[model samples]
Target: MPDLAAVADLEARLGRPLTPDEQARAGALLADASALVRDFTRQEITPVTGDTLVLRPVGVLLRLPQRPVTAVTSVSAVGPTGSVLGALSGWSWDGRDKVDLSCVSPAGSWPLSWTGPLPDTYQVIYDHGRATVPPGIVAVVCAMVLRTLLSPSMTAGMVAERIGAYNYQLQQGTGAAGASVVMTSADEKALARYGPRRFGTIALEAG
Candidate 1:
């Protein structure tokens, strides 16, 4: 879940309490966020190997095979530095499924796992000297998710929070570098918290 203090900070930065009209817009954006998360979980994460990649509503769980020096490429979205995409032995999910990708690495690999989902629409491409999966696909998935979750009335603050949540999840999972996935369980919780507020606010404040 997003930090309440952080939310307040966001509002402060925006220099205003959400207007009634802004609240209405925020609510709509929240609804879009909920829907986008749902679609991404259903369409992209679930069909993949749950053993290697656990897809929950909140974020994803990835298990590294061994400790090795691996280079994560095509992570333009994360920045040019290419964050730490080392060998993860395992990771812990809040309430999502557990996936083991221990078989995917070579010997002497530094094993480590990330525990979160994507933030906004970002990607982390892993280059293992072989054709694996492109990180851009994850970015694409994130873009779709964001698009699905956005609305015209969404407040800048609310949208920022949603985007922050998304980034927080992804950052938690892959650290600075790794493949991205979604945590369906946590995401559901997020949906519950943000969804109703988003939709209900529209009705309550609109009138």
Candidate 2:
């Protein structure tokens, strides 16, 4: 799941079979690019079911976690004494922090010591994560992988060198133009165009 781009896709972009080392390194770098995608979106790719998400009540409103939430199984309030109020009834999930209640429950009105930084007033069990990734995002990831495979000297510049992040630069070129200094490789230019440049505001907030 860490690999954001398929090996076949990278091979297609590379236009050749990867060596054993290149395959391994590409896998690792793909993982890094994936992590960047996750971070850029501020969303988790793999969210487990039956996990609880805590929402701090801000007046009558509460903020939910990253969206496309599948279900809300239960709700509770944290008491001032740190004990949890039992599950409540008559609450409907309306999406994106919009919840309808037949009546106010004990937990909903529960106040923390300081409202500036609030303790979670509400807790719920919900399943949530991105349902789809944009094709352009996937293309960017594949481009990054292709760039890494095309440049061995630039391995140190890949995100996987630090457990999942982009180094923000293309690999140096090795193709010589006679005795003149070699220019950037076409592969590197493609990567620079498709890599981080793809993470626009829309892509950043993409689910």
Candidate 3:
């Protein structure tokens, strides 16, 4: 995975050229910040292809874990021995993160007919995620990296607190380097859309 913000992005924000040491440190922090954003979002931040998943769908719909699915290449039924039994054709992609196996049947919610043991699992290969990282996400990640880069060390007591924002600034000093990086409540709210969707709600993606 690539970092959301590049070293050049950090340099642009600072409005000055980074020293060699600063560049190296900023690169490390940017990588850490990008990973943190992914952890917060709980989804892939960049486009991915040939992604595969195995599932046993319970209802007419099967929700994909990744978002903004561009294509579903294949959906196959798996036998007990994990061999590809056959290709399933009666399904549709919802254009975001769901696969719909249309109609219900006597065998189960999925429309399948068999006297032999019905397939209990399926394998789906698809392409998903954004063509470009969203600007908001990039900005947030850069901010996080900048915060950590500027204040690499912290003292014991809180320097300042913002009640409404629900954030506190730690005092920085020559005490220690590489203080733990964290996200604020505002950061969480900014990234909420990229996380897992709640039931009954649909996320629409632009084609």
Candidate 4:
């Protein structure tokens, strides 16, 4: 069975919601499992190489420190309503090459669409409330996203180690407020190719 499918099954078998601590552990496991599956599936291929994966750029051009050669092919945002706020085929990089999807901010002006340079790694933004999102679910998604970006040669163990570092960032409160899960790609090229597409962007309004 697929790693995600297996995770779903595990959740079902557990028969209980996960606490914060439990969620962290589960996320780590899910990350490793997903990486394994990806590697197995691509065994016949030439092996996952940085060049094999195409990274796109977005955001503003003047902001880029140096001119980029690539173009942005697609831009998408994943929210509950399924709306397309921004559209871009490519963008030039400035000093700011960061995609910030940390908190559940109000629609628009929140950079629902923009890009810059990619990072050397993936950065995850996790919100405060562990209520709706149990630790296990968070772990699974984080692992999957990281796998999607990482090269085939990179092991799941390495991903877990990176995740551990990310968790520390979360604990330090250096990330955006109320962000349950946020990820920034380390490879600037990745952002240039695949713009930020929201699978689900939750918005919270004050009463």
Candidate-wise lDDT, in order: 0.29, 0.53, 0.70, 0.30
* Residue-by-residue lDDT tens digits, candidate 1, 1-207: 111122233244456665665454444443343345434332221112211211112233232211121433221112123333443333322222123232233224332343343221122233221133233322333332333233222232222234543532222232211112223444455334222111110110100
Report clashes for each candidate as comma-separated counts.
39, 0, 0, 41
The reply for model 4, stretches above 4 Å from the true place, is 1-9, 43-207
Q: Who wins the TM-score comparison?
A: 3
Which regions of candidate 2 are displaced past 4 Å? 101-120, 155-207
Q: Looking at model 4, which ten-residue stretch has the lowest summed lDDT?
A: 60-69
Tell me the alpha-carbon RMSD of every candidate: 21.4, 10.8, 8.1, 20.0
Over 127-199, each residue of candidate 3 has an lDDT whose tens digit, in order, gives: 9888888988988887776666665244322344466858655554432223445676777899887787766
What TM-score against the true fold does each predicted structure earn?
0.20, 0.59, 0.74, 0.20
Candidate 3 off by > 4 Å: 80-83, 103-114, 152-177, 200-207
Candidate 3 TM-score, true structure as reference: 0.74
What lDDT would candidate 1 get against the real structure? 0.29
Better of 1 and 4 by lDDT: 4
Estimate candidate 3's alpha-carbon lDDT, on a 0 to 1 scale: 0.70
Candidate 2 has what TM-score?
Answer: 0.59
